[model samples]
Target: MNMMVPPPSHSSLYYCFQILLALVLFSLQMLTHQLEASSSKVEVLPGFEGPLPFQLETGYVGLGETDDDMQVFYYFIKSENDPKKDPLMLWLTGGPGCSSFSGLVFQIGPVEFEIKEYNGSVPSLVLRPQSWTKLCSIIFVDLPLGTGFSYAKNLTAHRSDWKLVHHTHQFLRKWLIDHPEFLSNEFYFGADSYSGIPVPAIVQEISNGNEEGLQPSINLQGYLLGNPITTRREKNDQIPYAHGMGLISDELYKSLQKNCKEEYIDVDSRNELCLRDLEYFDECLSGINHFYILDSYCESDSPLWRRSLTHELKKSSSSHLTDTVPELSCRIYSSYLGRKWINNERVRKALHIREGTIGKWVRCYKTDFEYEISDSVEFHANLSKKGYRSLIYSGDHDILVPFMSTQAWIRALNYSIVDDWRLWFANGQVGGYTRTYSNRMTFATVKGSGHMAPEYTPEQCFSMFTKWISNLPL
Candidate 1:
């Protein structure tokens, strides 16, 4: 692993980024007063990585402070052919502590897991081809430090939402400057889960920059989200919809009713029955050990567990791994073990889980949930006002940040339509579909999928993105 260290804390990337955001926020204030500034996207030379023939570069981006020299890891991947033919896609993984690089290893990249060995020992997911890399050159990053190979000096230095957005801006800005040839390429912001929150923030911040005529303008094409946690206020709000929509079974409904009045739900809301069911679902997933309960149907043995995701995972028995292992299962199970599981030579030598993983993961979740509900609203509205593409997608079976939560959040956006909303097949499958509202916002769903939409249904996930960016029907 390449280690990039910053100087002792006199002047740091973190401080500089904050200064930049303060300046941008102040500029927005002036824009409210009708003040004018100049904005344009930067141009950069296309990157290349020799023998492979595609433009690719792996390096550290300077951030935080000039004197202290804080930095983040990012890989720029692009097509070798005409830049205009493919759009620039930024991919981020959740865990706020997790590295964008992990996405490269697990999902949308040239490599994917082959799963050569699967004994009782935890299966080490390996490298295989991700269908998305075939459509677009994807960039993966490690933000807020301690994720994958990303390094940070201390815990306190890595936990701020404001800091995350600031560093992200500088990271992209530097990327554009370093590779000026792809100036005309369209840029799309995207991520999954907790990142669902940060993606909007970064996109909105960029759009805000455009409105104020400050900084360079990015094409800011649109956004692509997979089973994202888009709304906090709507957290428990989706239960009724979940029940009414038949997402949960009648048996599960009764279980919820009996338990909530006695064991789980708060029941103060309007949809008491629905909320009860949703609370049962939440209680069913409160701990990592109970994770298998969420998708027990993926296996081929446990009858009760097998019934949970019956509609989603079509296996008749339990004990069999789901068609595709969930990234959530992989993460939570690993996180539960902490450094104890990292002692293996392959793991220790391959990545730095023992050193920075814990801090990054812990801080990532802390900052995301620590804010007021209104903060999310401001972030979403600001994103739409700036012409940035904002997307909230859900997997029907994803209990973590369920589709119900996303639906409520979309209703909250209320972005005025530039074009009438359109609905159509997303992957040519009856179960998958897309709906575009106001020409700038999109809400879509992947059928029979859980938290990691792409892992469960790569073809559908790829189809959704290709159509979204190219403005074509699947």
Candidate 2:
């Protein structure tokens, strides 16, 4: 028996609605894919004259239980030389508050600010010849939220030390899930300055996660650090380092040793003699540039000086050079140019930065972040026992966290010296000195460089990094 059918007009209407539903679903899927792609896409940057010559992907990795609020921003640059086979390095810039862009544009990234002069417009970017991107793939990250373009929905998400380590470990695991292509690649954790307090723990966390059969295992290899602050107070060898650099007299040094009992930090407030010695010591070191002894201390007008003073103000409610004001140096002026360029709306849009997420893009974001972990020296020692390769480098001229202090901590590890101290050369000139230990650890110095070695000696740093990463002698 044949069933009664609807009229032709009704049948046509039903078919049309079905077709429209299908089309809508397809469009929604496409939109979802496009959004995902856009999150990791960077087509053009404002400062650059033309399209980006190399691959630069900017994105955010969601963190925490829900993976919705805490977003960590990152700039991933594929290796210009060999993206497929080159080792992948997670580069973290120190400050516990410094934006990773400082390392990206100023140190090892593909481009640098062309600050021949500042005309109030966006500072142009020039190709850096010695960028590390030529050798290995790098992910420059703005971590711990509240940094650069990274932010969290809740203000309490701002983390410190161990919490940072945990968050970073989770970030890497999720980041690899997003970009699975590099999951099997040789992975490394690297940082500079205050990162010394957290990097080792981060590495240890990764090692433990991998050992515990965590999802999307990372091919953990080793780590890199430059002028690291291994211990909170002990690593700050300012006075002794000053004496070695001839910034102080032997008499004053002896007085500090005798009165302060060789402990310069956290001295007894009741000891008037110790306080007097430290006062004299402070006076002697007042005019010196702690970051780079050789470089002239650019006065308050300098952006770098202002930034440093801002950090000092945040930490201690005062600054040593508050009364002194002088002319801006060219380097400091160039550094200031980066701030102007990054804060530009056009540049931010081109880089795919989220609107209203960050108010200002400063080199270092000053905040009251109390770190959970006091020190990470034990983490380094534990990592050493794990047989992972490690590189600890210092800028010899840096007084803030001097090479002598780094050496003293390494000595505390009691690792046998595999190779004694020797000069490492680049372009037929003695670039620096290096030493190797039995525990797969190497310590080196960049001669005439400041706290930020690559920023000061890009070519030499590139040479040193390329060789070190390749397991070759520097």
Candidate with the greatest TM-score versus the true structure? 2
Give the per-residue lDDT of model 1 (tens digit) for 1-474: 999996758567778888999999998776532211112221221111123434446655555444123556666566434556678877888655565654664456654433333334433433334356666767787776555444555635665666677668767766666566655778888788667767778777776665677555666777777766554433343344445555566788666656454323235467566565655665543342221223543222222221223212223212222233334334333322222223344443233223333332321222232222223556777666655665566776665456766766676777554444344454455545556677377777777766667766666776676666676643
Q: What TM-score quantifies how close candidate 2 is to the native fold?
A: 0.88
Q: Which ranges of candidate 1 are over 4 A from the true structure? A: 1-55, 118-130, 213-216, 237-294, 297-375, 415-428
Positional deviation of residue 232's Cα in model 1 after best superposition, in angstroms: 1.6
lDDT of 1 at 335: 29
Model 1, TM vs. native: 0.65
lDDT of 2: 0.79
Q: What is the TM-score of each candidate against the true structure?
A: 0.65, 0.88
Show how many residue pairs clash in every candidate, following the order shown: 33, 0
Question: Residue 438 lDDT in model 1?
Answer: 75
